[model samples]
Target: NAVDLGAVLEQFSLVFCRLKFIFGPMALHALDLVDLRSVLHITSPCGRSTYQVTGSSGKTYTCYKSCHYCSCPAFIFSVLRKNDSMLCKHILAVYLSQAMGACQELSVSDQQMCDILLAKDG
Candidate 1:
């Protein structure tokens, strides 16, 4: 006999909803990839290196190789979700791509976060 499973999933959804409500929404950055790249160029500690961010909005945002962080709500969400070191994929990509000039502090921070997660899991 087949059993209906919809109700079981509904309970999980309720739990998730409650978690979200308590957390007051997941942290997420709202900035576009283009603007994030620009900010990285202007604020990157390594000076400047030209790069381009092709946004889903079809507008290309140009900046230096140092661009990181979306400067958007997604950034916070990413952090809350622990999806990435930062909320913006562009920022994570920049860090991953620009190894030579990437921020050591960010690397350390990532390692620490990983360690914390691992410890919690174990």
Candidate 2:
């Protein structure tokens, strides 16, 4: 059976573009099934504005609320590369946790914690 290369390429391009729009510019096909389940844990030792997200992959990434930045590959390759404001699943999970008040808050110094809170509020 002969494969139609042009047709295949076109289909692939369409799917890629759709995924890019949905999951930012990163080629995160594996993350298509990502959701709150993809996040293993959330910790904020500094404050609410700074989060440490542990994904299902067991890798921890830093997320900043002030700038909506995540140190994950998806964010680095997609959001930062494309200059997009979209957040990755891990960051989204953090937002969800925050909304539900489920994030495990860690202890921080009074000054630093106050600074972070002020920064977030202000």
- Which candidate leads the pack in TM-score? 2
For residue 29, model 1's alpha carbon misses the true position, in angstroms, by: 16
lDDT of 1 at 19: 38
For model 2 the TM-score comes to 0.49
Q: Write the per-residue lDDT of candidate 2 for residues 1-122, one digit (tens) a residue.
A: 24788888889799768766765633353343233344333234543446666665677666666677766777777677886547676676665566546666665665665554442321
- Candidate 2 at residue 11, lDDT? 91
- What lDDT would each prediction earn against the true structure? 0.39, 0.58
RMSD of each: 15.4, 10.7
In terms of lDDT, model 2 sits at 0.58
Give per-candidate clash totals. 15, 0
Clashing pairs in 2: none
Error of 1 at 69 (Å): 3.5
TM-score of each: 0.26, 0.49
